[model samples]
Target: MSDRDTTSLLTPELEPQMDSLNPEPAPRPSRPRQMTLNMGPQHPSTHGVLRVVLELDGENIVSARPDIGYLHTGIEKECEVKTWQQVVTLTDRVDYLSNLANNLVYALTVEKLIGDIEIPSKAQWLRVMMCELSRLNSHLVWLGTHAIDIGAMSVFFYCFREREDILRILEMFSGQRMMTSYIRIGGVALEPPRGWREAVGKFLKQFPSKVDEYDELLENNPIWLNRTKGVGFISLEDMLDLGVTGPMLRGAGLKLDVRKTEPYSSYEKFDFDVPVYTDNDVYSRYRVRLDEMRQSTRIIKQALEGMPEGPWQADAPKIVLPEREKMKTQMEALIYHFKIVTEGFRVPAGEAFQAVESPRGEIAYYIVSNGTTRPYRVFMRTPSFGNLQSLGTLLEGRLLADSIAALGSMDFVLGDVDR
Candidate 1:
């Protein structure tokens, strides 16, 4: 019952072994420290049903992956089933904003396959004018939406107000605003509607002032400048490697425009400068597109002033739709019209690719015909799909808040991307 007896009892019998009670701790599995976020298949800022899988570390993006196909319409395969002329309608849906550009490219491709069918000077000039107008329509939408995304609400209103004028002009010509389908294979759908000159001329006259208004609102605004000026930069080399085109490419100081370089639909005859900037940021893109709108206005003005006097459509009676007046009076015209409506005109066995400068960039159609009424193969090289390739390069290493500005600068249409 002394100290030795008490210590021996406590040490041997009463004490618990800590080592036996608890086992060794397991190590955590190796993984990245970044947080993953799915920005959208529904996010308004993503610009469409595009889902971006973002890997972020403390609000800085580590990497970004864009998920598409939500807007896919199987348009290429659908083109195979449609007749030569009927495919024009399908082209309209591919790039809804630049539907006329799509129409012209498809028409030009088909015309190349058909061989040596001359498009009249008047038709060529008209195509130039309409496509320029379509370019204005697209740039306006981009400006409004992009400005609003950056918290410049008033710029959006100003842009859309002018956009309404362009839409009215389109409606006057084609009887539809967005998807005109007015540019047919051989020529336009209808004779230029009455007062088209006055309407288009009026719009062109006032459009430069409207662009100046947008510049006044956004070009010098501190918030707009801070949000966009130094943000969303991708290298010219990266853009070229990734097939980026349009304002995004031009903003990087590359003077590549399909209208200027390739020259389809009489674009060569109309003179306009391709806007280029060396900044390669969202602000540069905005400036490039704005300048493009001004250039489009200039081309449209030239087209209106110097519209040639000739047949509106080509001389190919079989390929071009007969006039309503001619169809009523002549048996041959009536029969040809009936045959064309029921059985589409045959294109010679060949393959052709035509590229046009769409609002977003170089939009091309590669079509193959096997001496059939329908296309054997139809493939589109859409600008949105190309421009979207730069998203990862633009978003990575940048703050998450800047992603919206980066996305807006690309100006990609979901239909154009997923088609």
Candidate 2:
């Protein structure tokens, strides 16, 4: 046989056998076969401008990637050029759920930087009363809306009904329902209103019973239980890695609370407990926040009962705006008010960090100044950003139904997350 003919015959037969022996390219690992679904800068499940990219295999979410910055307001950057006094106003928008808490943290930071201003005991205690009520207000919004997200309609109305009373009490004191920038650097925005004590006291008396109602409606309800009990469970290891705090951490049984650990705004003086759970699931988180609402009521009652009476704003003319009457009568008071409103107040060049136990978690502000009318820099360590990281981890392997339950447990406010 000719050599060329023999080679051609063997090439077709032997090439097929040789290719089979080379491992078939390992099938390219199948590219992992994930279906990516974008779940909102608009979807209802996200709760805000937060968009989560879900990588799924059928009904199970194999991975959840959180796409943030949709609601970024640049509130932090805007504060840098504003005077220290003006920055307090910016803090109000950071976490609207706990605006007072945000104001309290920022004010404390600026106050610490400018040395002590002799904040009155009355002012300090009033901050306590209002802040706890603020926490209760935040939880009500979270529970009601979260329940609504999960298809429980009753919790929404019930929680909002109580929230309205709290807001009314807030308005009586500061003349604003939600953004009561009442907490100032040296003291409150105003003295406790004439009827605030009675209003708050009545609410306080009944708020605990209302919380019991939330529990009655959802605690053991078969639908709620099925949706939340084991869904969105995040282990301690994952939580630590993700930097999640507040109810999310407590839900995992860590019992780490800034109020208990660091004790700000005279939090140590109050007798309250930080609730914890070992389950680390959606229901555990709901339970922890609900318990926090109860504890907050207790603290508020104590504050109202022992409420002190004194000057509401600080004596410092440089920081706090003088009274309107004094501004007209006294040249110095008038000048100080003009300077504070126009150029903002100056602080001694220094740095300070103040953290508060906000309803969602540890809300902190790291402030720095060059002793000028405006802040050199202002950075917020918001709780929502920390809590958002766990979504991907918690959502992985969860069914689509469980995604919402887990998201609700996070109690994320994109306003805070994006700020």
Candidate 3:
């Protein structure tokens, strides 16, 4: 072979190099470095069947997308087939932790459609008391599970210990612990059960101290503070734009509770302050809910001490069910009871929207009636669905480990989200 050809074969062509004094590194391939992770439709920290799609750059999240509907119940569509009265049972499952709050919002929406049906003052006060109790139940569950998510195991047991008392009180009133279906359209399903005052009074008396116990366990703990305090922050404007509500909204320093801003079910009669904090972070949300539990206790005390004396149900024989005793003795009462149970009472043809403060946030029901026994259309504006919208804003740009703290702070129920 020629010398030139042998030299060409021995040495490959080389690219020009930079000056030795100013050497530049070779450019890296321009492709995304992010990895996508699925956090769960089964992961325990999700608090329900929620799947979060996360894009991560190393240990930090680049973006997050909440993929929901793993727990969809089709409850709103189910309502179209059920009688107005029969639908109350279904509401209890929407947010099982706050069943009474669901029951109340549903009952209030029906009552509005029925044209100013006069709910007794006693019933109103009782509804308020029960709803507050439901709030406490929800907050307890949130705190317990959230603490455990952050590795504070002891707080879970302490929270459930107090929660058992609230559940007992609820059972006394409705005869069912979680799915009571106690709040009816015209009024509550039945008069407050005997000895309810004593049961609730005992819980109220001890609950403040129980809350203090939780505070001691979490508020000053270095591990908890490190995990939560400055993490999971989203701006107030972004939260509002995303339609986030409940303690998340309150924690961002916005005083927009449905109970306080738009009172229903005699909530105006109760004197309680809506807790607000300015931090707009996970710890602020924790503080707001703690303060809320105390306020709920205050409302329950007022309801217990000043419960009015009147018929628990409305005077409308056609709408409210007759007493069992009256049904046995009186033919008219028997017919009304039979009709309400079998045929269901017809609401006037109209549409009504009622919003109430549930444990998670502003839960509103928009119901349409065609002057029929069943609702024409039923739609629920659930807080979990609204608050979940902020997940992207909250988790993006945060450390992957911090996602758990941010998610736990939102306190969403999947049933509520997907219903």
Candidate 4:
């Protein structure tokens, strides 16, 4: 008591709690501690096994920390073990929603490394069409799932209806819906499947109206508007600093699409507007992706109409596989096919980075070839990883109820994040 009185500025009567050391724990402050919550190593809204640690002051989020790596497949290190062609399958698993884009970028990097390899015009156009469809497929899933996350459950059904059509198209080409890996180095996996044009034409014709239907359902709905608009705001400067791209960057009004800025796989030939929104909120990201679906339909229509008449693969027999029929009859073709199947083609010694605009964002593959059938080093600069870095920025100081909208707005694939 005497020590406290000597140290206190006020008189002994005014020296409130008496002892400074261990003063009855300050009566527990009469306030609750901020509750810490783990939102998904398996939460549906997370889109994958993404764990976000949130500190909540009542319903308001005090802070959020994203804990990732639960879905890590070690794909990059695994790429080093696979042949040049075999790595495409690994890339497919990197972003489950956008396998075609993965195939295209990795193939493009290999093509660049090989040098002087001419991808046929038909193949390029086909690649463009498939990739754009992939973009549509991805956005549809994002729209459906994100809508459901925000409680617009009906939109989810409509979005999945359209997504089924796109997946059917993919299956027609690759025999697998999600991991088609159709886009291959120097060409596509197959000459566009028979009746592919008719199938695509059917889907494209009905797709626009369906998109309009989604707008009808959600564009003006009060709940959707309330949950998304003016929520989860991150400045354009912050987005750039965090390396956020795709619709996230576009929503910030940056217009920084790798497709437009650095067109690959004949993307420069397409005429489609890059959707941009200046609001930089969850609603803005939603609008940008919806508009992107329309633009993708536009590109697909153009691709189908101007579909080229040429080989579907380059004239590199050593690199590209001969037809299955050719393998059976022609001894020379059989030998080459066997050789390519058993031992992958050797890429020239060099390094190349090929970045493509995937559904999520910029998906680039950096390949270092040491004159080997397998990559000496392979690295992926995935957009989900970049976009995930901004989760804290989006969630901090926001309401807990808004977390789903904020997370879904990023449209990140956990495989892409953890790869």
Candidate 5:
């Protein structure tokens, strides 16, 4: 009985042909045409040199991989070579958008190690003000570039218009624009300019209206709505998985903010709001940043009103550079300066991780000291680096063209990532 159909298992085509006498042609399998696209490391919308390789079928993206490190400058490794104090200059280049914030975090880390050096209350307040203002500047650049990418050109101009003022204020305090490097290890690199109060006040007075302009221009514009609303959408679950933070995560309705959750640099003294949103899309992100500027303004105003009166640097002359005036008259001051410049200060053996809410997200410094002038390892957990991790995830299944707005909204700075 088992041998009845044994020939049916024969692995011969000719033997099977006998069963049908004429075999119908086998059904052909369907294969969708694959379209490979290269969205550049040089493209304007990418915000920096980031090339993304994408596979698409029709308007849907099948897969995407972000190719970065195009702007690699080895800043992190270079820190090992620079002096603990000299490293401030290099910090400005990291998130170029939030240079002062970078300067503050690093300087503060090393400062904390210095023995019993008193950081004046005024200096701390100024630091908080500067850090918040830097956050606004960073968000401004992001909004302008991001809006331009999504076809909102006017918002770009309006955003930069205000950012120019912020840059001027930073320059007034530090003698430089984007790379202030003003926040020193002990305190600030320079004293606040005489008219800084009026200058910053005038700018703040006009800045709120400018934010409103951005809202009016893009908030309700039909084109802006169609392009951004519900686009480049991400969820809190995905954001948490990808380690996303900052406005992007908050826009997804997570009320987590480093400044509020983990206050630093006297941030707890400031009274302000942390804007949140339930729609984690380009439009909502725009709203979040726009409103964040308002919050930043409130902090700055309070800081200006309560501007403390004291020395800007830590009282330790051994670690902090003495003022040029004091160095000329005082022998002890001159010797301290000479020693710091020639031999450097000795940091105790320890490891500490310090995080600040940078413009893009959390900018953290993981510094290890081996009781020497040089750090054993200094790792920067740049916000852009963390934000960049969400790129592929946010970009998957999106339209090929939507990548521009999506990436723009991510506000990734290659320098931040490659570092």
Candidate 6:
């Protein structure tokens, strides 16, 4: 056939329009669609392994959902298997930056269950000093890392310099820098080192200047201000509803420090301000933490200057380990030491909950003892877990870049959250 005849025979008006065989594609939706982005479980800014799923409309976060549990160490469950005293070490791993705080809270909780045990005045003072130093340490880390995240690299170096001094002091006290676990159940793990007063005095004397240096660097820098001031803000009501605490809550102008309100471990004996701010933003949180470091120094100075003269450990023979000299001299002391070492001290059959103001926020230990050496049940109401609940709230309807600042302001430790 001719080419025209063949083409016409094949065409048939494009095969009867093909409209009956297939309908036209539906019109595209008019509005643009959001896209989901996975931030990370390994993001350096997350402070640990924490993944944030963000639904973004262009560069604005439409919604944010945190995917946690990547760093679940099962430390809480591990606590149940450990002796009451052994668990202090486990607590040290929970919020490592605030290791002393965790150690103190767990120690205090166990002590509460062991009721009527008189922790020494010296020991109490020592605990206050160590914990406040821990607070300083944790806040220093937060400031350094947070500042670095926002492009202030010098602050990280300055903050870590002082932090190194604090870590050395911790090492001197407990022979370990990061996970000291120095606050034992009835008292500190050991007597304060001989030169501890001088060492701590040196750091405290120098620290205020370092904080001022940080302020000089970041407080007025236009880039820092633009990144933090009035950014990542949430109302006090929303914060409270989300269980936000620590600097995040304080930044909202609430005087809700657990140290002030509850006064555990002789916090009432110290005089300091809670450092509240009405702004409720990243800059406010930054200011609050800086002031907290100062207050912690005040508490440390008080603890050092007026340090009580007495035994470092409680007189409770059953709970606290006996002195080595006494163990060598007295048979009864030897027996108690052996017993406490071979088999852990038994806690009275009861439940006790003790809360403390950690660097992150309120970290409470809820413990049940069935009159056994091992805990019946151990649960930690960790601040990071509570504070992380607000991540989604803090990021929603905000710029995608603001998410890191908001996360850093919360200062959450994933180990604390996952436990």
Residue-level error in angstroms, candidate 3, position 334: 1.4
lDDT per residue as tens, model 3, 1-419: 35554444323334334323346756756997889998898999998899999999999999999999988878989999999999999999999899999999999998988886999999899899888888999999999999999999999999999999988988899899999998998898877878888888888789899999999989779999999888999998998999998999899899999987888987888899999999988999999999999999999999999999989888999999888899999999999988988999999999999999999999999999999999999999999999999999999899999999999999999999988
Taking all chains together, each candidate's TM-score versus the true structure is 0.92, 0.91, 0.93, 0.92, 0.91, 0.94
The top-ranked prediction according to TM-score is: 6
lDDT of 1 by residue, 240-337 (tens): 99999888889999999988887777788888899899998999999999999988889999999999997899998898989899999999999999
Better of 4 and 6 by TM-score: 6
Model 5: per-residue lDDT, tens digit, 21-103? 44675444689877988988788787778888888998888888888888888887888877788888888899888887899
Candidate 3 stretches greater than 4 Å from native: 1-30
Candidate 2 to truth, TM: 0.91
User: What TM-score, to 2 decimals, does candidate 4 have?
Assistant: 0.92
Query: What value of lDDT does candidate 6 attain over all alpha carbons?
Result: 0.90
Candidate models: Cα lDDT each: 0.90, 0.87, 0.91, 0.90, 0.84, 0.90
lDDT per residue as tens, model 4, 170-269: 9999999999989888799887778998999999889999999999999879999999999889888888888888898899888889988988878889
**What root-mean-square deviation over C-alphas does model 1 reach?**
5.6
Worst 10 residues of 4 by lDDT: 19-28
**Better candidate by TM-score, 3 or 6:** 6
- Give the TM-score (vs. native) of candidate 1: 0.92
Scored by lDDT, model 3 comes in at 0.91
